[model samples]
Structure formats: C-alpha cells, structure tokens
Target chain A: MLVNVLNVISQWAIPLLLLIIPLYGFIKKVPVYEKFVEGAEEGFRTAVRIIPFLVGMMVAISVFRASGAMMVLGSLLKPITDLIAAPAEIMPLAIMRPLSGSAVLGMAAELMKFHGPDSFIGRLASIMQGTTDTTFFVLTVYFGSIGVTRYRYSVVSGLSADITGFLVSLYLCHRLFG
Target chain B: MLNLIWLFLLVSGILVAAWHGNIEVVTSAALQAARDAVEVCLNLVGIMALWLGIMKIAESGGLVNALARLLRPLMVWLFPSVPPDHPAMGAIILNLSANVLGLGNAATPFGMKAMQHLDQINPRPGVASEAMCTFLAMNTSCITLLPATIIGVRASFNSANPTEIVGPCILATASAMVVGMSVDYWFRRRNRRRRR
Candidate 1:
C-alpha cells in the first residue's frame, strides 16, 4: 500500500509543481510579456492556418489504415522485424509514419491486452512507444508556423531518427528482456 | 485554394493506398482516426491549461528572466546573433525546459513566442535568418526528459515496467539532437564558405 502511494505521489509531483508556480504569473501580470502576448497571438494565427494541413495529414493516415495497407506492409516486413528484435506483430505498424503515435499505441494496446506485456507484441509496443516521436507531423506544424519553405535535410534526418529508434528499440528489447 | 487541392490529393492518395476494400469501412475508419486525435488532444486540454497558467505566472513573476540570466553564456555561444536580455532567449529556455519535462502542448506557446521574438530579430520580413533555422533545428530535436506520453501509453498497455523506457528515450533523443545540430552546423558553415 505504501509503495503504491509513493508511486502515485511521484507521478503527480511535477504536474503539481508546474501548476503552483504559474499562480505567480497570474498575480503579477508583468508588462514585459505583453509583447510576448502579441507574439503568441500571432503564433495562434499561424496555428489556425496550419490546421488544414494537419487535417489533411490525419485524414490520409486514417485512409491508409482503412485501406489495409498497414497490414500488408506489416506482413512483408516480418523478416526485418524478426531481425531487429521488434515484436513481429507490431513492427510494420511502427514503420508506417510518424504522424499517429496514438493509433500505433492503440494497436499496441490491443496486441498486449490479449497477448500479455512480456509477449512479443507487448514488448514491441513498449519499445516503439519509448523510442520514437512524431517527427514529421510536429515539424510540419512548427516549421509551417514560422514559414520555412525549405526543410532540406529535415525530412531525412527526422525519419532517420525514427528508423534508428525503431531498430534500436527492437535490439534493446530482445537483448534486455528476451 | 491550391493548397487545399494539394491537401485533397494527399488525403486521397493515402486513402487510395491504405484502403482497398469497402468504401464505408475505409471512410468511417479515416473519420474516426481524426476524431481520435481530437479526442486525445481534448483529454490533454486540462494539463495544457494548467501548464499555460504556470508558464504565465513564471513569466510574470520574473522567474523566466532569472532562468534566462543563468543560460546567458551558453546561449551566447550557441546563438550569438541574439543579444542578451532578449525575449527570444528567455522563451527558448522556457520552451526547452518545458519540453524536457514532457509538456509538449505547453511548450508550443513558448515555442511560438520564441519564434515571434526571432521574427523581431530578423530584418528580412519573410525570409528566415540563420539563427532562425538553427533554433528550428534545436526545437525539432530538443531532448525530452520525462517521456510522459510514452509512459502513459505503456501504463495503458499494461507494461509492468513503464519507467524502463526512460533510459532509451534519453539516449535516442540525445542522439537525434547531436545529429541535428551537427548537420545544422555543417550547412551553416558551408553557406558561410560560399559567401566568403
């Protein structure tokens, strides 16, 4: 019981600290950040402009899932997945794109729910979730906000990180847990 | 209109590639996926609101400024273009700190604020200067400290040891940042040579 309580407290600690300090801002209302406010408003406008782009990306991701391309891809990559120590069940899904982190998580959950965490599917999910981030989607929104038309090395570099992450996670999982 | 056309084509392409079967299933699935994203974002709203309030308070309380003062030397070395006491520097530090703690939704406004401050530094109206590009690179590859979202997903997925991911998360993010910064430096140097 005590251990569980400690775990809960640790989880909530940073969030609570984050909340308490901001009360200071509300009380003071410094004039310095007024320019910040104006800038933020501008950024908000940029965010609005980019929503259509995000929607398109999301819609595309959705359609891909619906069309069953994900499954086909997963099956074809089974050999590589096996090589990398990735959960064979979830490896193809991880390779799909950097956009839908949650969808992949959801898929991982489904796999784990039935198979158990130490199972191939569950460990793969755990590793994938830990290893990579939503690089392309985030870059689009961020760079779009600032109006960067030329993202020369960004695409390859970001995806390279994602792929590197996938392979590493696979290797780590098998080495450490398997 | 043209952007929208490009968007439509992109969506159609994904749908065409991914969905091979019944139209209804594919269409409904696509819609649900978007909805799921929104739903997750909505769930995150409370945390974001709390963090926003905290960030605002920190800014008002002058804590952010103090933090910037501490970061001064390093910031100067990394971003010589932006002078000390600059709002961009403050916002950049704040954004990095917040992102380190795994508050992405919270980090964004500060990121925007940083960019806006960068915009102020830029003499050119539309074109991004080198500093701006470097900052973008940094922001994109910034190291995440906590990996909150991943942990949450792990807990939800019934992992016995969600925290085990902490090590790999740190290593992987650090690698990306290193690679990103190196590439950014190489390109910047190459550009300078061309100018010389």
Candidate 2:
C-alpha cells in the first residue's frame, strides 16, 4: 500500500514540475518561450562540448570491459567487498557508477539480465545507479567547461560520497529485500 | 589525478587484452563505444533542451529566486564563502532542487550555470574555491528522492515492483549527502588552518 503511494508520487513528480514551473512563469508575465529558447541554445552548446569527454570516458570503459580488466578488478576486490557483505558481482558497477553514467547503465542492464532484476545483485545495482551521481564525469564536464584546473578536495569528497552510497545501497538492499 | 586514472584504464586494458590474446576485442569495443558515446549525447540533447528551457522560464519568472530564498538559510551555512544574495547561491539551490526531483538533464544546466556563477566570484581564477569544492561535493552526493531512470530500467527488465528500490535509493543518497557534506567541511577547515 505504501509502495503504491510512493510510486504514484514519483511518477507524477517530474510531470508536475514541468507543468507547474511553466505555469508559474506565465503567471509572472515572463517571456517563457524566448527564455526557454535561450536556455536551450546554451544546452545545445554544452551538449556539444561534452561529446569529447563522453567519448574518451566511454572508450576507456569499453577497453576496461573488453580486456577483462573490469572482471579482474572485480575479482581482486571480491574478498574485501564480500567481507563487508557486498556481492562481488556488483563491484564493477559500483566502481563505474561515479565514472560514467552510460557505462554504468550498461553494466546495470547486464547485471539485471544475468541475475534478473528482482535478484539481490540486480536490486543493489539499480539502487547504486540511482543514488550516486557520475562524479568524475560531472567534475570533468562541469569544471572543464568552466576551466577550473585545480579540483583540490572535490575528488576526494566526491569519491568518499560514492563509497558511502555504495555501502548504504548494499546495506539497504540486504535489509529491505534480503 | 584524472590523467593517471585515464592512463591506467587505457594501458591496463590494452595490456590485459594483449595478454589474453583478445586485442581484437579491445579494438571492436573502442569503435562500438565511440558510436555509443554519440548515441548517448544525442539522447541527452532532447532531455537537456527540454529541461534547460523549463529552467530558463523558471529563472525569468523569479521562481528560482523564490526557491532559492526558501533554501537560503541552509545554503548560506553550506556555502559561507558565497554571499547570500549572490547569483551563485540561487543557481546552486536550483541545481540541487532539480537534482532531488530526479531531473538529471535539467539539473546539469543549472549546475553548470551555478559553477559559472561561482567562478565569477572566485578569488583564484583557475583554482577552485572552498565554496566551489563544497558545492561540487553536494552536487555529487545530491539526495535523490526519486530514482526515475533506475525504475524505468527496472520496469523494462520486467521487475515485479519497479519502485521497490526507490526507498533504499533515497536512504542511500541521504547518507551519501551527509558524508559528502562532512568531508567538505573537514577539508574546508583543514585548508583554512594550513593558510594560517
């Protein structure tokens, strides 16, 4: 019963925001169409700028996967993650989570295919994907676009947060679904 | 740091593939990944345009400022270096709120704008300011209320209950946000002490 309500809310959340914000703009007598076009023009430019970074990261991820490096890394980290009650199969997803969204999305799809989306590993992967942002990607594109060279402390905090998210996802999945 | 990671990924991947006699796999993968990258960017274009357009209307209508005002107290505490009335503050607030609402595409433009605003007031041109680091930390660990993308993927995969992970996602993100903020605070304090 509770799940149904939350699901409904989540479904409506984005649509409502899209509708209400524009309505609010109209009410305020703003030139909504012009402003939207202006912002979207910037968005198009930003999207173009991100292509190089996206390709670089994606190619690297592909190499990591095709070369079996991802599996090897996952194996190497298995004992440690297992000791902490995390399934080793999902380790690569956790590592890739903060790096590239598309890479991790692909990983999640693979995991769901192999383990079934209802499986514990699949659930954990889904939660991990949802909870964490692409840290390195964001830093690169956002900071790179603005030319912020020295990203002191940002990487540390970002990765730490990712670790926390991973651990929490594991714990929550185990407790809630296991 | 990013350079090292990139280098490691490329070298290790190629080395490992060579050792396994699967060099062809690496070649094919790279080509496929390049194509995928273009596809991903193209997918983002529509989403980005839609969200950025909506966000612009919100900005012009003063909705962003109103939302920023509501979040100002907490934001001021988080970004002490930034003035209360600064555009950066509003941008950051809008970015975070967008993120929380699971508007990743919309959030990116706002986040980019926030970074630009933060950069305008940055004392050191190239070096990231304390405020920027804090903002980045928060952005990276922004608490997500709805894992919309994940749920959609799960549904596509025929999960019995697609939204089952949502509860856990929120909890996990909340924890991440707390840890991120704490680490940012620690780093800020330590950096200040070093200067003294």
Candidate 3:
C-alpha cells in the first residue's frame, strides 16, 4: 500500500514541479522565458569546464574496475565477511556502491537475477543499493564543478557515510529478512 | 586527499592489471572512460540547461526563497555558516528535495547551482568551505524516500513483494544520514580548532 503511494508520488513529482515552478513564477510576474535563457547560458560553459576533471576521475575509476581490483579486494575481505557471517555475495556491490553508481546498479540487478529478488541476498542488495550514494562520483562532480581541488575532510566524511550505510543495510536486512 | 587517491587508483590499477596479465584491458578502459567522460558531460548539458533555466524563474519569482524559508530552521542548523536568506540555502534545499524525491537528473543541476552559490562566498579559491563539506556530507547520504529505481528493478525480477525493501532502505539511509552529519560536524569542529 505504501509502495503504491510512493510510486504515484514519484511519478507525478517531476511533472508537477516543472509545471508549478514556471506557473508560479509567471504568476509572480517573473520574466520566465528570459530568465530561463539567461540561466541556461551558463550550462554549456559549466559542462565544458567539467570535462577535464570528469575525464581524470572516470579514467582512474575505469582503470581500477578493468584491472579486476574489486575481485582481488573481495577475496582480501573474505575473512571479515566470514567473521561477521554476512553473505559474501553482496561484498562486490558494497564496494562498488561508493565508487560507481551504474556499476553498482548492474551488480545489484545481477544479484537479484541470480538469487531471486525476494531472497535474502537479493533483498539485501536492493537495500544496500538504495541506502548509499555514489560517494566518488558526487565528490568528483560537485567539487570538480566548482574547481575545488582541496576537499579536506569531505572524502573522509563521505567514506564514513558509505561504510555506515553498508553496515546498516546489512544489519537491517539480516534482522528483517535473514 | 583527492590527489593521492587519483594517483593510487592509477598506479595500483596498472600494477594489478600487470600482475593479472590483463594490462591491455586497463589500457582500453582508460581510453574508453576518457571519451565516455566527455559523452557524459554532453548528455548533462541539456538537462542542466533545462533545470537551471527553470531554477532561474523560480529564483526570480521568489519561490526559491519561499521554499527556503519553509526549511529555514533546519537549514540554519545544518549550514550554520550560510545566511538563511542566501541563494545557496535555496539551491541546497531544492537539491535535497530533488534527491529525496529520487529525481536524480533534476538534482544535479540544482546541486551544481548550490555549489556555485557556495563558491561565491568562499574565502579560498580551491579549498572547500566548511559549509560545502557539510552540504556534501548531507548530500551523499541524504534521506531517500522513494528509492524508485531499486523498486523498479525488483519488480522487473518478479519479486513477490518488490517494495519489501522500501522500509528497510529508508531506515538504513536515515541512519547513514545521521552518521554523515555527525562526522561532518566533528570534522568542522576539529578543523576550526586546528586553525585556531
């Protein structure tokens, strides 16, 4: 029941916002069209500016992935997963969650497909995927956009969040579905 | 920091690929990712323009301010460095809202706008501000209400109850947000003390 409501809300949200923002602005006597064009003028420049930073970040991440580093890392961390009695299957998803959003989603889908979405591993993967943002991507894009190279504790805090999210997902899934 | 991570990723990746005898794969991946980066930016230009333009109308109409006002108390607490009436506050609020609503595409433009606004007041050119760090901490683990994509994926797999994970997802993300905010607070205080 709640999911249905949420689905409806998500479906209607963007359309409603798109209509309402402009309608309200127009009602408030704002020069909506001109303002929009003026604001949009910065878009190209901003996108272009992000190219170098994005390329650098993406190449590093791609190289890491293509090197099978995750598999190596997964085996290295096997003892910890074994110690905690957590399913080893979602480790790759957990590790990739912070690094790349699309890659992690693909992992989650694959997990769900192999294990069945209603199974413990599948449900855990689903929750895990939902609970954390792509930390590297966000940090790269946002800071990169503003040319802020010295991010200081942003990364520390971001990784902490990712770790916390993963642990909490594991705990919740175990308690609720394990 | 970022410099170290970048170097580590590059060096370690090549070394690992060499160890695994797959150095060629890493080479292609690097080249492919570089091109994909530009492609990704090109894709973002359209939505960025559309949302930014609409955001301009919203700002000019005073709607952004109005929305910001509604979240003033919370915004003030989370971002003590930013004035309540600042454009950054409104952009931050809009960005968070888009994120909670699971409008990923819409969220990026507003987030970039927020970063720009935050940058305008930053004292240092290349260093991130306290507010920026806090904002990022909150953003990276923001409370996710919909988790729409996950649900859709589960449904596609013919799960008996695809939404079963919704409640768990919310609880987990909320916990992450709390931890993220607390860590941000701790870092902010530590940095302040160090500077003193």
Q: How much lDDT does each candidate structure score?
A: 0.64, 0.85, 0.89
Task: Tell me what fraction of the real C-alpha contacts between chains A and B each candidate also makes.
Answer: 0.24, 0.81, 0.82
Model 1: per-residue Cα lDDT over B1-196, one tens digit each? 2244335544554555545546676667667766754554445444434444455557667888899999899998788789888878988898777677776676766776677678787767556666776776666666776766656656666677766767766776677667666776777778789899
Against the native chain B, what TM-score does each candidate's chain B reach?
A: 0.76, 0.87, 0.97
Instruction: Estimate, for each residue in B69-149, the C-alpha lDDT of model 3 and write its tens digit.
Output: 999999998888988888999999999999988888888888988999999999898999999999999899988988999
Give candidate 2 regions above 4 Å deviation: A1-11
Can you give the lDDT of residue B140 in candidate 3?
94
How much is the lDDT of residue B60 in candidate 2?
89
Q: What is candidate 3's lDDT per residue for A27-83, written digit by digit as tens? A: 999988999998897765777778888899899988988898877788899999888
Among these predictions, the greatest DockQ belongs to 3
Using lDDT as the yardstick, the better of models 2 and 3 is: 3
In candidate 3, which residue pairs clash?
none
lDDT, model 3: 0.89
lDDT leader: 3
